[model samples]
Target chain A: MKTITSTVMLASLFAVSANTSAATLDEVVGKGHVQCGVSQGLPGFSNFDDKGNWSGVDVDICRAIAAAIFNDSEAVKYTPLSSKERFTALQSGEIDVLSRNTTWTATRDTALGLNFAGVNYYDGQGFMVRKDLGVNSALELDGAAICTQTGTTTELNVADYFRSNDMAYTVVAYEKSDEVVAAYDSGRCDVYTTDQSGLYAQRIKLKDVSAHKVLPEVISKEPLGPVVRQGDDQWFNLVKWSLYCMINAEEMGITSQNIKSKMNGKDPAVKRLLGEEGAFGENLGVSPTWCGNIVAQVGNYGESFARHLSVDPLNISRGVNELWSKGGIQYAPPIR
Target chain B: MAKEESAGPPEVTTKPWNDPKVRSIFFQVVLLILVVLAGMYIFGNTADNLERQGIATGFSFFGTTAGFGIITHLIEYNEASSYGRAFAVGLLNTLLVAFCGIIAATILGVVIGISRLSKNWMVSRMAMVYIETFRNIPLLLQIFFWYFAVLRALPQPKNSVNFLDSIFINSRGIYMPSAIYEDGFSLVLWALGIAVVAVVVMTRWAHKRQDQTGQQFHTIYYSIALLIGLPLLAFTVTGFPLSWEIPALKGFNFAGGTVIIPEFVALWLSLSIYTASFIAEIVRAGIQAVSHGQTEAAHALGIKAGPTLQLVILPQALRVIIPPLSSQFLNLTKNSSLATAIAYPELVSVFTGTVLNQTGQAVEIISVTMAVYLSISLGISAMMNWYNAKMALVER
Candidate 1:
């Protein structure tokens, strides 16, 4: 043992830990795929179906990113992460972009060495209570026991809301979202609290869909969006504009079906956005047709919103999620 | 002396490996170098990685306000408390669960261990069944079953099952009447302390007198009386200063009483019951290690069955039991980390999960948590080792 150890020690003296730079865009292209981090499962956001196929609003962001880079929506891999592991995974460069429904908080963006590209879904914390409880608003939830998963923005949001409102509440926090749902379903707690969109999505999993009501009050702003690691500005811009391109396209009457017709349009904003007028994509280190690929492959923001969230299974109304042109806050910069 | 000189001179033609002194010195030097190098490399690696990431690699976060509310804490805590205080609350809660679990398990274990060796057929078989049922199943599942399935099946606050109008049981938790000590309670505590000291002095005198005069005294009965009677007397003299604050049903949960949260109950119950199974096995083996001949010999010497078992068999059996029993205690303490699974807000659940996520200081938080658990395990073993030494047999 002594001889073997000495030999290994002698050998390790010459070994080196080679350092690699954080060039996420080049790395993704070199690997021929974009590694995207997403939530474990949140319907209309990052849910996995029975066939192991991933879909939702967050998944569309990942696909748009892949199309922007590789011109193919399928050139992407999904890594499901929990709330606790999402930040570390991004920081360690294990995934290019965290496309989970992570809230863009000041601490997360600045302190945690992360950068929130842009808001994909504007939301806020809301409460879901049993209709039989007759709690119409959060003010009526005094002395209530709230059920929420720990280690997320929802827990802290509800905590802050209750403290500020001078209401006493007992929080029954579970580690898993499903556990929180089960606990709430089992009547272990009186109210279930999470993001407004999440409450709508998770309400479908409850025991009785019609028996619970989501209160109208939004207690905290939770601008859920994709996250990228800090110090990678080029990669940040790619992720930021990928979502922006979709939003701007939605404002420009663009959709996945009509993207081909608008490819050679005469409009300057339309031409520049579709790569016919300028070298914007070249400046961002991708091809000139990056926005076009994103629009053609992943659809516009409104299409994704209606498909995954608003009109279908999730049925979440686009409240703050609607385009700014339509009185919502989802405004993106013009392609010019 | 002559034979030794001859043997030494004859072994002059020796190899380095053949010499015990040289081999040990060489191995020690190699191991020391390896250990130091490994430690330095790890520290350097961590420092480098932290610096590169621009993370504040210090313990300054401990002093900052945590800005979070913990649901279960022994110490007074709020959102305004420092991170260090939050950590203290978590540590205290962990110790609370572990301490209660150890005491309960020890009592339950000894009873069941002895019952397993009972003369009646049903008692022994029942003990066997219990041990098998608990030890084979996973503890995490047991905690969840008790917490989610069984405990949640109880009634709500308005419909709570009341026990004599002092306690309330519901899905939320079990609320019992808490003692509200009024002023002048310290006098009662002083009386209890004095009574304990007197009992100790009496036990010593009894032991010495038995040694010198060969006469036995009712030391156990006297001690029990002094312990209970003095406390009661002090209470009566003080005009029942301790008042019972009965639980009252409020809007959602019962207020005013000391409500043990269902998470605490589930974690405590699961840990105690699960650990008691292993403890029962250890205790049974310890008793079995004491040969049957010892008990038979004591019986033949005119000692009663209870005294024979207690004085003769138990002392000997304990020597075999202490080592494994101490390990089981440590195991129970470490298993308290499973509190995270059921969200009891113990050390790991609160500190490692919430604090780490909030501060985004994974490296510092994880190492500190590890150090805490390590110290707890080491501390338990040290105390038990001292106990084992005390219980050890004296020999010339």
Candidate 2:
């Protein structure tokens, strides 16, 4: 009688644990696609094409997740959300993952119940002004009316920048990025401010790109990346490791075309990651070809960045985005 | 015979509790239970999820240092300030814009409403045009136009336009003379208060006399005299204490004077212009609602058009106007939330967006913001309702 009761108790414990983990993975697999929330229109990061297909550096992250799940990078439904609506949409389960250029801060991670997968871009706040203003440095912007977007860290940075310099400024704020850009172009504001990358993208669309210049001053640190809901550990791991695979793949000198040749490479880390040596895929509840599928399907992080942002007409250099071994900040953990 | 007739109803005798009223009560009870259960279930799920994720669920963050930045504020603030203080600043900024917008809109709305019925064709038509043009466009677009297109286009600080030797305008903002208090300033203030009280008493006396004797009195002229004469007399006795400190163009910007930033100006201008259109319509409708016979009757009694409006038309028109006008006031208060879109540090932008992001207390911040708006809306409507009741006509 005692043995029978103990067996039943053990069975119930396993049953409970099994039920909890089953729900998250089952839901994603059943849906057959991952829902990704992206920025409205930040060029080279996340923007819609003429065919209404979303494409950018951030969009690639979502595609990598899709490849890991459905083995098809195209199985992603993209939803464009504003900064204000992005987190709420995630919390409400409106989107499975958010790959907008969202900054990972301590408060957001702990307080908002979110898990940032990994940093995709290292950015900082910067200012832009017309060349005619003759403002060589940010300090010369004293008493200037600055056009900035609301609901961003840029707003607070404006106050701090002015106060620290013992200067005053009138802030003209708008809600949308387009409006801020338009205001700056119309001569309504003496200066426009945002992330350095955003300023570069916005400047290209200006009527005369050469007329305006982004200032040399970088005001604040903005480490932007993908984020997911906090409760789903399985989903978080899938996302976190998918990003890790990309970074690791680049560090291993594994490109999309070379992934097949490197499958039998002598490197233990590459073997384990590519499912040639270990059962890492089993632990993630995915097929053995998960990492290989992501590389073959979506390419590595460096490849995506080069194809979309760098070495293109935009020609954004990979200053901080390069692999750590190559003197950049991107360092991935060992897959083993 | 009555008992026998009553016994006929015994075939289907029913108790009060079995009636439709009782059934409705029981149904409502069930619905209430179901709703509570559903709410508790969702709340429980959320709490469990939060626990599993190791996210704290509480309002303790309100006391924590915001550590996030705010761009514009009416009060002193820093990243080290508590979230509570930040919320206070946001609430205050919202009230500041709403109060200014209401007063300015009311003044413009009244003038335009009166002018629309003017004998001069140009005046009425111009007023009509103003109302039509502003009323048709969205307030958000107007705010964007003012903040981005109009204010941004101003000259740089170096080339700011100087007006009246004391005021300056640039992309930065407007600078003008600030009041400077010296010795004996209180005497000037006391004199002004006394002048106002004197005018009020004289106006009351004039009204009483006119009601009793039916005689004409230049009450306006007498009231103006009492209001200005007493203040001037006191100023002469105590020596004028007030002084002005005009703003001067300094190295980079204006110095030694008050500065009104462009954000505040854009928000105030857009809100007033947008709200004035609605108020004008309310005023026109109120005026039109007064029967034509009332105006004709007043004129037949030898009353001029001005008095006919004041003594006969307005009192009745106010009865129709106060309710809708109150709604417009509430709407203006709510519409001020858009101030966030322009970084005016209004309630929604400051508390909901900035503080929430800084503190990571979304649920608490959003709840507080909603409560602030709800209270302001309720307070305005309550005051309006009281005034409406007082102004309503009494009919036999």
Candidate 3:
């Protein structure tokens, strides 16, 4: 009986897949909205307001993509997904693009049959302990109980760190970041470990924010970026180059307010990038003013970074995220 | 009847193979075939799409090195380990939580369930309040509350709350004494094994003698005697083998003992409390299902209230209760999947979420997880059904 039911289910799934294969791109374009996957809630990364308006660093990328395609930033729908559901949603075409704080790994890129457009943030796993514990360094946490989120790369890093250091520590694993923070705060865990950026975000939420300090040791590299499903080359190019345009704009000193003036500038590379010459957008099946539309609608990479995640109020520095010319890792290919 | 039979035989109207019933079956078979064909066609297209994109399909990745990390696990794991081993660790962690939660829930649930029906008003009200409070709220919220609001408020390890000079509680986790084994531990284990075997044999002998001689033997007392006697003899023969490793404060945190993380405590406590409410309802219904007259009848037969309940009411009530009770148990098992929300490293969190993403084997990993859950549910149901059949009233 179970087999029979499963067979029926399999049949239904096939019918849906066949129906979807005809023209997925047309369907997305015709609908006038790109369904972009995002994180549930990560304050400055991807969070929704009480009015249901979505805004974040990742949110701006989705908006930028939409602007490049439809010439309107609002022509996008956000699908907030947990870490577990994000891939499946992308695989099933529930979302046109995934702009969540997803890490770019070989297994995810090749094994999951997905393509990462480009790296947006170069992050690493780190530990956060209460200041009163007097543990100034990750090495000082030899026998400490660590609160960690399960189903993440952070989990394995914790185990590896402890084992390599020849220190025995108990692990209090949770599924969500919030719970990991809660457990750590409740005196259930000696330390809370995750991405350094996440540690900064969560530390502020502690009852006594002054009491906790994020340790200096970075255990592993986590290059987080946007992604799209494999097999759609045109759509992939459109998203990939959109991010490149932002980075290039930042490098070439292009801002939203000065993009029009910069279009008539002397530099041939800048002219080609600002769509003053050549037809690069036509190759990606977009209008000639696609890059112009993206910059105008969502601002350049620096603007987006400052507006959402700068060191002003959120206090997030552009340490590794700064442009390559500025001693950072964000280098983009030439528009020409 | 003769006229009808003659007419039908003449026309061969009752052709069993061509009858409407048979045709209906045939139609269903054809429909099933069409459906299966359509399904296969879609699956083939997807495979082709994946192939064109150079994406390898199948479970072969399970044998590959994970090259990934995990936060907490009972067994040893490394980035160099096979995905299969990582999966095993995930399964073990899930089973560990489920096993612990089941025992805790059962004990707490039975106590609360009985209390709801107690004569003491405050006790019943308290149980009622507990049921209403925990059952209505979502499990995820409770986990967050426990982890963030409750556990995160703990004192630092240096100022950990000490109790009885053996246990320590702080933001890190609860530290408790673990039993250490000495040279005599082997003798103590053997003695315990012998005691268990002796008790079983004595109970069988007592039952047989009672049947043969029409004389009742206090089997419980005899069994208890054998169980204790063998163990005591062994302990006397060999010096006590077990020692205690009382947890003590080291440089900062408690060292040399077992630690129970607050995440585990929160998950376990929340699950037990939430599930106990439903279990209480089942217990109440099971008790109510039994006829009240059976108690009176048992009383007439010289059975006391406790014995009457044990002998007459419970056996029958259990028949109705077992089916639903099994479902509740299955519910608890499935609900444990929510442990992922709190980073419990259950099957869903480890295998499906992390491993699948790390390996990019969504289809294979999800299928494996679904199969594991299906088998667990089926296994529990099968066990319950067997017990039900054995205890069913036999009527001639």
Candidate 4:
């Protein structure tokens, strides 16, 4: 029975790959929906609500791409994936784009045949401990039992941090983010470690949300972004530029509300981005209003981030994710 | 004249196509060829797809460092260990749980099975209730119930329930005093080994004497004395060289003692309880298959109920029990893969879940994992078959 199931799984895997010859863009058009992969449930980063709506920074990236191509932000189908299954789902063509809160790493980019379109959120690995544990800093977490999601760079990052500091710790890894959060919340682990943003997002799920605090130490750089299968330059560029267009729109202070007013503005960059100036969208095999559609539908990067993360429920500030002109490192190339 | 004519029979010739033997063999060969072709096609297409997808493929990733920590490992492993070493650690963890689960399940199953056969209505009904309740539920849900519901209800380390100040139970795990053997521990081990061998030889001699001279020797009493006394004597003579490392609440968790992680406890408990339910039914069926006349015959021969059960009924019931019991064992081992759902770091969780995701070598990792399971199952089946053959009824 095991043999039969594995054979069937492999057969289906091969069958999916047999259509790799069809361009990803063509396939998405034919299917009439962009299949976007996201985390099963990570609030403020691609979470599904009770009303069957998907929203978050990562989810918005996919929506922005859909808006750019189909001129409709709703023309996307979200596939929730666990950390372990995300890459496989993408490689098997189960998803055209993986917009999960996945960290961009060298091993994944080169070895796993994946490409990082661009960083949507700049993050860093951190620890969250119960306030009563009496540990204020990550340094005090020696000999601690840490819970983390499996198949993510957090595992390796935690190992490196503890080893370099000559500390002893134990890891209790779960395949899904919810399981890790549950284990940590149940007091099965002394510390919960992941991206700092994830710590905040998962903190909301705990029974006593105010009783936990994320540590101050940022162990590793985690540039969370969307990913696409390598080798399709056109699809890659479309996803990449979709994110770039949002950042550029935010940089030029052109948001969903003011995009129409600034469509005929004198600034060459603004005019070009708003589809009033050049053939920028045509080069990417999309309509002239590709950038305009993205801004009008999904809003600019700042607007999306503020709507999903920086506002009431999550309240995460745009610390390192703000535009470069605002002293943050988020920089995008000129549209002209 | 009729008898003489009957001496000559008509010559017969048959076509090979019409022959059943030839036809069966020919069809089998064609089937074999088709199967081989299918296997090759699957492999060839997978290779082509892998290349086209630009995913790296090879076994060299095993030698690379696996920078991840494990919660519980029987073998020595650190984050610095290679992926191969991590694989070994995961495999050892799997074997440990399977071995411990089998023992616990068999013991609990036998007790429950016997209880179901008890003359007491309450005892029989309670056993029936347990079997039905556990067997009807899915094993994964039972595992979650144990891990997330039961174990999760335990207190944290600071509020751990201490047993005699030596063992501690908490949400973290059960922490017990681990033995630290110093010099001269080997002498105690040697004494124990010798005692075991002596007891075996003495039991054989006692059996022979009972058969030939109609005399019984107290082998059990002597065996117990030899086994315990010899080891105790060695320990005392060696100046009591063993020390215990007791666990105590330190910064966050208990330190300096052997701790059984909660994941292992949950998995082991769930697997044992779930499998024992099925095994209990199997044992009940085996015991019931033995005829009631055997008990009556033993009673007529002036044997007590205890002796009748030990000598007559059980030995016969085992003949029915051994075959199906092996299947339950295999099921338990395979079901341990569900450990991946929780964080047990078993083969599936560590090697397939983590390693495969990190390396993106799904084909190699999954194939190795499946092969490992297959081998373990085959090994259990072989051992059970040998034991079944030995216990078979020997007829003169």
lDDT of 2 by residue, B126-191 (tens): 999999999999988998788777665688667788987878888667877888877877776787
Q: List the per-model TM-score of the A chain.
A: 0.93, 0.91, 0.92, 0.96
TM-score of 2: 0.87
Clashes of each: 0, 5, 27, 0
Off by over 4 Å in 1: A1-20, B1-27, B209-215
Q: What's the CA error at residue B278 for candidate 1, in Å? A: 1.1
DockQ of each: 0.33, 0.24, 0.42, 0.55
Error of 2 at B130 (Å): 4.2
TM-score-sorted candidate list, best first: 4, 1, 3, 2
Which of candidates 1 and 2 is the stronger one according to DockQ?
Answer: 1
What is candidate 2's CA lDDT for residue B15? 68
Quality of model 4 by C-alpha lDDT = 0.89
Error of 3 at B172 (Å): 3.7
Q: Highest DockQ among the candidates is held by which one?
A: 4
Show pairs that collide, candidate 2: A187-B152, A187-B153, A188-B152, A188-B153, A189-B152
Error of 4 at A14 (Å): 1.1
For model 4, the docking class works out as medium
Candidate 1 structure lDDT: 0.84
Which of 2 and 4 is the better model by TM-score? 4
Per-residue lDDT tens digits for candidate 4, residues B1-396, read 234335656344447897677889999999999999999988888778778778788899999999888888888889889999999999999999999999999999999999999999999999999999999999989988999996678998889998999999999899999999999999999999999999999999999999999899999999999999999999999999999999988888888889998899899999999999999999999888999999999999999988898899999999999999999999999998888878998998898778877888877787898999999999999999999999999997
Best by TM-score: 4
